[model samples]
Target: MTNSTRIFLFFSFGYFVSYLYRGVNIGFSGFLIEEIGLSAADLGLLTSLYFLGFALTQIPAGAALDTWGPRKVNGVLVLVAAVGSVIFALSDTMWGLMLGRFVIGVGVAVCLGAAFQAMALTFPTHRLPMINGAVVALGGLGGAVVGTPLSLVLDVITWRTASFWLAALTVMVSLCLLFGAHDTAPLHNRKRPTMGDQLRGTWEIARTRAFWQILLFPSIVAGTFYAVQSLWVKPYLLDVNGLPGATVDGLVSLLGFAAVFGSAASGLVARRVERWGISLYHFCGLLLALFVVTEVLILLDVPLPRAFFWISYGFLGGTNALIYAVLVETFPRHTLGRVGTSFNMLVFFLIFLFQNAVGWVVELWEPISVGVYPAQAHIAAWVILLALQTTAGIWYFASKQPKKLEHL
Candidate 1:
């Protein structure tokens, strides 16, 4: 295989593990609640710790990528995720699960950024929109597996055993990345920036108004998308739509399947439209707005086919990834690791908040049963999500046309 192909496959597998961990909780939530006596809030706290760990590591991980390159950085850190998965599999207590999830988050935090960094270094800039989308789509199969496939796995084995398998998979990926993937062509005559210099560059990227404008809407939207996909959607299906376990799993898998297409199409369409003078930024905004509409329709509990809104949610939701391509166009390539991770920090931190908030909101009402919450509770949380996303969308659309960042 070509070196570039090797890089894509290995790095993409790393991201697949990352995405798998993110959504694994969805498949395991019922098992956790029944096995560990977890409440909705407790489940939220545990599931979101992964995102918290992921968010916390973004800045530092970015700096490491710039200094040591993606292969070395991701290889070493993903071992931490293996350790975490072991912890999670063995733990019966809430605190133990939270710790495991957080460590896993820290371990895999670099997966997406590293993959994108390696790709950007290898592929031409014009091709990144499509390539990045393809990577996300392929990685999204991890998400797809956590749905019906995970349910089927759990039918034969326990969640703990499944987690053990996941850990082993993680370890294998780490070893392959460390041994199989070559580092980017090194900087030859240039002094590698000190950690301080790398951090300062990150700060410079952070301070740009255009950066906030470009990232704000999609960050919130992506956070909401992940929050639901990872945790609450199962409960929502159970309580709101009154769907059975088998049906819910199928729909969840359908959402995952739909998102893969959404991800693949976003870049292809964005690149295609750019020839007609449409900006990537505007295309992302349009999809995000349509995503908001999907949420509204979902909340309205419209009598339309139940699958329709979910398919729309998955499809439109995945398109937010197009923002990365937009960032590539706006920022210098040298700063991309930092810029990408900084954006990730915001997206995931918000996911951390949004996931917990959904649970906290649901907890406001009494449960209909041992673990099932009332429909009103979920609707309230869903409305709050809409309000936040819609407000961010408005700000994005209302902002002045983005100008080039002065610092870059």
Candidate 2:
């Protein structure tokens, strides 16, 4: 393979596993609840802990990528994730499982941020939107795999064994990164910034009005989408809609497939819209409005086709990938690593809060049946999430257009 193709595959493999690790919890949710007797609150807290770990690492991981490069930094982090996977597989108690999930989150947190940084370093500026979208589409492949394919694997083996195998696969992917991924030299020809300088640079980005404005939409939409997709949706389908396990798995798989297309399409659409003179902010706002509509439909439990609702959720949800591309394009290349991770930190932290909040909301209403919360409880959680997302959309539209870096 050409070097470009090799680099793409190597980084994409990390992202694939990053997504797989995140979505694997959905496939195991029923099993963990049944076998370990976890409450909805417990499930939400445990899964959110992964985002907690992930959020904590973002700024530091970004700094590391900027200073040490993605190959070494990501390789080491993925190893940590593999170890966490093993711990998770072996754990019988909730605490052990939570700890494992947290570490796994920390390990895989670098996958996307590092890949984006590498792409920024390697590719031309104008091409980043499409390239970034394609990378995210590859990550969606991982999400797709964990849906039906993981469900099939779980039918043949216990969740523990499946997790153990996932751990092994993570190790293999890490090794590939160590051997195959190579970072391009710094583009600006400046000396590498020290850790202190990195922090100061991050702080500069954080202080900008444009940064906060850009952050509004993605943080809310991406955070809510991830919280729902990673934990609640499968249970919601099985409990509220009363779908069979196989059918729910099929729907989730379809959601994953739709997300793959959505991720790929968002960049192309954004570029086309820009060519037509629409701002990225307005385009993103339009997409977020669509996402809110879908959430409202889901909350009302409208008597629509199940596949349409779920697939719409996944497709509209994936469009948030364009937000990352926009951020990359707006920031100075020297600070792109920090800029990407800073935004990611905000997004994941919101996801952590929202995920836990949804669980807490669900737990307020007693389950009507064993392991099944009331449908109204799920609806209540959706209402709160949707409201927050709608508010963010309004905030983005109200804010003045973000100023882009001139050097780009």
Candidate 3:
């Protein structure tokens, strides 16, 4: 295989594993609650730890990607994830599970940023939108599996057994990434930035107006989307939509399946819209708006086919990932690692907050029955999330357009 193809496959596979780790809690929540006796608040705290660990790694991982390249950084880190999976599988207590999840987050945190940086190094700038989308779509398939496929697996094996199998898969992927992935020729000759220089570069990326302007809407949308998809979507369906367990699994799986297409379409559409003179920023805003409208419908509990809204959510929710392409266009190629991870840090940190916030909001109301929060609690949580997202959207549109974008 071509070196570029090898890089893409290995990094893409790593991202696939990362996404699976992110969404596994959704499918396993029942097992966790039943076995560990977790409440909504406890489950939220446990699940959000993954995002917290992921968020913490971004800046430093960005530097490492810029220095050692993705192959070395990602390969080594993924082993940590494998170890985390083992811990999670063996643990019975909440603290043990949280520790395992946190370690898993730290391990896989490099996957998305490293993939984006590695692709930027290997592929032409113009092709990145589509390539990056394809990567995310593949990762979304992992999300898809964690829904219904994981449910089917749980029918035959314990969650602990499933986790152990997942860990083993993670270790195999790590070896592939370490031994099989190749860096582009330019990356081999690039100068290593000092730790001080990398930190300064990361801070500069964070402070840039273009970064924040491009980030606000998309980050909020991505954060909220993950928060809902990873944990709360099942509860919402159960309590608000009154769907049966089997039906909820199917719909959740459908949402994941739709995301695979949606993220892929976002890239293709972003490229196409640019031909029509629509800026990537505007296209992103449009997707974010569509996502918000879908969330509103869900929050309102509209009478329309429930699958329609969930599908819309899955499709539009992650299209904001295209924002990485936008960042590439604006930033220098050398700093792409920092730029991608800075964006990711905020996005996942917000996911952590949004996930925990939903649980905290729901915790305000008494459960309608054991483990079933009231419909109003779920609705209230959605309202708060939507309000924050809408506020971010308004701020983004009202702000001056980035100078880099004027030419694009």
TM-scores, in order shown? 0.97, 0.95, 0.97
What order do candidates take by lDDT, descending? 1, 3, 2
lDDT of 1 by residue, 200-270 (tens): 87888888888989999999999999999998889999999999999999889989888888999987878
lDDT of model 1 at residue 170?
Answer: 94
Q: What are the clash counts of all predictions, listed in order?
A: 0, 0, 0
lDDT of 2 by residue, 27-130 (tens): 88888889889988899999998899999998778877777777778888999999999999999999999999999999998898888877877788677778
What lDDT score goes with residue 272 in model 1? 85
List candidate 2 segments past 4 Å from native.
187-195, 406-408
Q: Whose lDDT is greatest here? A: 1
The true-structure Cα RMSD of candidate 2 reads 1.8
**277: Cα error in model 3, Å:** 1.2
Model 1 ranges with Cα > 4 A deviation: 187-199
RMSD list, candidates in order: 1.6, 1.8, 2.0
Residue pairs in steric clash, candidate 3? none
